[model samples]
Target: MVINENLKNEIEERERLERLYQNLVEKMPAVSYVMNLEKEFSFTFVSPQIQVLTGWDPKDWIDIEDFRLKCIHPEDVHEFVEALKRSIKNHEPFHHEYRLIHRNGDVVWVEDFASPLLNGNNMVESYQGVILDITNRKKAEAELIYNAYHDVLTGLVNRAYLVERLNQILSRRHPFSEQPLFSLLFMDLDRFKIINDSLGHRIGDQLLIEAAHRLQNNLFPTSTLARFGGDEFVILVEGEDPRRDAVQLADQILLDFQSPFLLDGKTLFTTISLGLVIDNGEYTEPDEVLRDADIAMYRAKARGRACYEVFSKPLLDQVINRHQIEALLRDALKRNEFNLYYQPIVALKDGRVVGFEALIRWITPQHGLIQPSEFISLAEETGLIHQIDRWVMHEACRQVQQWYQYGLSSFPFTVSVNLSGSLLHQGNVVQMISEILAETGISPQSLKIELTESVFLETSPSVNQQIQNIRDLGIQLQIDDFGTGYSSLSYLQRFPITAIKIDRSFISRIDAQYSGTEIVQAIITLAKELGLEIIAEGIETVSQLHWLKEAGCDYGQGYLLYRPMDAESTEKLLRNIGKGDEVM
Candidate 1:
């Protein structure tokens, strides 16, 4: 039949719209479907995505009854069916998530949204729905949740998770009623970092994992052990008699560590220090209790490790004091609280001043004055000695430069500054010295670095090489308090030593004690043979100085000639010496 032009155009328009809708459905990534309301969930239409999403062909599902509902996970089927019922009966849209079993036998998370399709009479006729695969998103969310409470390296509950567990236990009014009187013990390995550094980190990691496993196996059956980070572990025990139990456990732990751990064909020995606290009647916050345990652990280390200690108030107080001092020291370098005092080194033959040793003194405004013995050791303990050493070098260099400007002295003389073992062992010691020299414009020959015996013992070959390299830069190396140490004559032959200072212990009794005189003589003879200059220290009397001069000591320093004085006093004393005052 021939149709009117207007009717023909309308038919073509409707056909074009239907083709567009089909193309959109076929190309969509999500599965789309329509079902009727006769309890017959036939796929009246299905997108091509259905095959990829569910491994089922569109034609296969075309006449299938309730195929989608059958595919829903057994666990989520009730929820899914109830939502579908509400959507159909109330004529409202519904959204839900369920696990879908695909034809490949794999379960996946899928989000479904459906709306009740209505006839022109406003009555529900069918349902149209879309399904989105959200398996990857669900997996990602699960991982994030898991990682939030677990340590990634060890796969153990982290500190945050531990705190949460503690809170859960504490929130209960009867935690100790049947759960057994619980206790938490913190464990730290002694000198663990030395193992990490001397050996590589790989070995250190293996050692830590082995330690964790040992703790797990040997600990009480109900105990939970966790890695608290490098070399630290926490053990939670649920039992009675916690005090005696903790000590016994610590002893067993030490015994287990006594056996050599064979790793990469090497036998390594390790020990641990433990801090334990019983959760008897006293109530304490988790963090506060952990802090007290940490303090006790340090006390264990101080008392010669491989032991355990219970928390005490006095130990915590000491920890607080140490922290306060450390905090103050961090700013002390910037506050200009430190100064250098010079003790003159004199030529015994002519009684003329040759050089000086720069000693550090702290001038705290609040504390009045602090001795080097007090803060210097503290600095070493807190790893602040490197900064303090650098400051001393700069100040000593500046003072020598000042003396040069004064022209009181004809030429720049060696001003010795002490070097801490920590500074010497650092890999960048040579580079630091070179940089400081370049920055200060001080002649390297005029600066002397005094090292003690412990410095040599702690330093590696790389460090020893660095020391030799710096010495080659024209700076002198002097071993201070030489006779006091395992003072070996062999180091003189091995090291490029320029000078040695006889310890005051030998010098103070040179004339009174025969053995002291023999030690002084032997040291002087050795210094001459080794071509190393000798300086006798702590010559407090004229008789001692006379004896030292008779012993052919090249230089001597003591309270007899001059005590350590400020730069101004040192300059004045030197000026007096230039004028030949009180020289016999």
Candidate 2:
């Protein structure tokens, strides 16, 4: 009786333990699996959760031969098999992540882990493992990768990818590869900023997307296309003959943008400038390729956009020169290397000096006597023009004050200073000029503001308002280097323009052929009709002066009348003029 009770109790306890194990296996999220290695790699036991995880019943794993292999992604099968074998051979634990084709044909990623079940000899026995669904994690990883390499707006490869791929190509090429050359075309869309400023960014984004599609469509299958951010794109063209291909590709790109883009009903027209560099196997860094291509792109833009330029040493030299100028210009004021020279603006009727134009000159310790033509543009680009403009205005005013203090104020001659177009954008421009005149104790009439015709073409209402404020302040407004720009006579009617300085280009072309004579006559006629003054620049010859006088030109200035001189020389000339004597 005692023995029977013991056996019955033991059997019940075993049954309860078995039920607990089954419950654990069924409740777990992962599919628990056991394999028999002595025989073929086959499943001996699999959790019922296999159905929930991979849509396969537990029985299917055991009944079907090589069921896992059949479901394993083809690309990962070898790695999966090798991992299991390695774990069993070494009698150690193992882990791997690989792909599996689900019963519904959707790709599923699984994190597989296995523990080798070895005998006393530590030889092959079997592997017990679990596979947890990691498809969501894999999807997250892929999304991160895509975002890292591609632009979100256009769905094109971004600059990061361009740098990576460019470096890869350059690394694989060696002397034995004969050149293994490629071409990089750097493209920048012209007038894109205007579009962004005029239309909304939403429309601009749409235009960019369409432009990207156009560029990607034109590339060869082997090539790579990437966006360098902000209306700039770079292409890597791979071919045995990359030079010819680059030219053809650039030409095609120009043609592509030639047609207007219709975006949400508005037809917008735009053009692109291309800078191309045919790789000669000399570059080791990716940025060098990009830098050279960028240099060329600017050259294309300089030649007027909708054109292409190939990388050259001279372009690099020009870029270096620009950098030097920018660096020097930034420190020019601080070092007191800047000086002002005055060129007299003469009245054609009596050759009497009516006013003087302040021309800035930089006398650098390293590079002597740098003219405005060499560095003024750089100053404007670097925002140094405002500082320089303020200095010239104050200095000219002070010099005029000095002339008055020294009895050299000849009939209250006015001093004209050219204002950079950038300054007109300043909301405080009128106030700034007002403060400068007030601080110097100079009358506004003695200080004239000179601007290029390009200034009148500015569409800014604020700028026009600013000009009106200057005129209201009793300061004279004149257009310097006129006839070279595209402003119309209507500007004279619109702005408070007191005079127009005809560009030297028109004056220099006067000859027996009467070149530019008609243009001059037209300008003089337009000025006369509007009751505006006209001053001819670059009057190097008597014939030019004679012709200008005959054409009713009111004022002139150049090497012929008076070269740009220092303040002392100009004061002397002013005294001479005060005495009713012409210096010439």
Model 1: per-residue Cα lDDT over 1-584, one tens digit each: 35688899999999999999989888888888887777466678778898888788888778677876787789998988888778767889879888988899898899988788899989888878898999999999989989988776677777777777767656663745634356778998876766677677999888887887888777887566777788888887765565666677888998898888888998887888888877644554678767777778877876768888888777878777777777777889899888899998888998777788999888776676777765776788788999999989988888887777777665346789998867766788888888878877778988999999656644456667888897899999998998775566667888788999999988888664333588889989988998999998898977788888888899989898888999999888767666667343
Positional deviation of residue 482's Cα in model 1 after best superposition, in angstroms: 13
Any runs in candidate 1 off by more than 4 Å, and if so which?
2-27, 35-51, 55-70, 78-91, 117-126, 146-152, 157-160, 163-253, 256-290, 304-308, 327-378, 389-419, 425-461, 467-584
lDDT of 2 by residue, 32-71 (tens): 8898875466699999877776777778788888887888
TM-score of 2: 0.89
Q: Which residue pairs come into collision in candidate 1? A: none
Q: Best candidate, TM-score-wise? A: 2
**Number of clashing residue pairs in every model?**
0, 0
TM-score of 1: 0.60
Task: Please give the RMSD of candidate 1 to the true structure.
Answer: 8.2
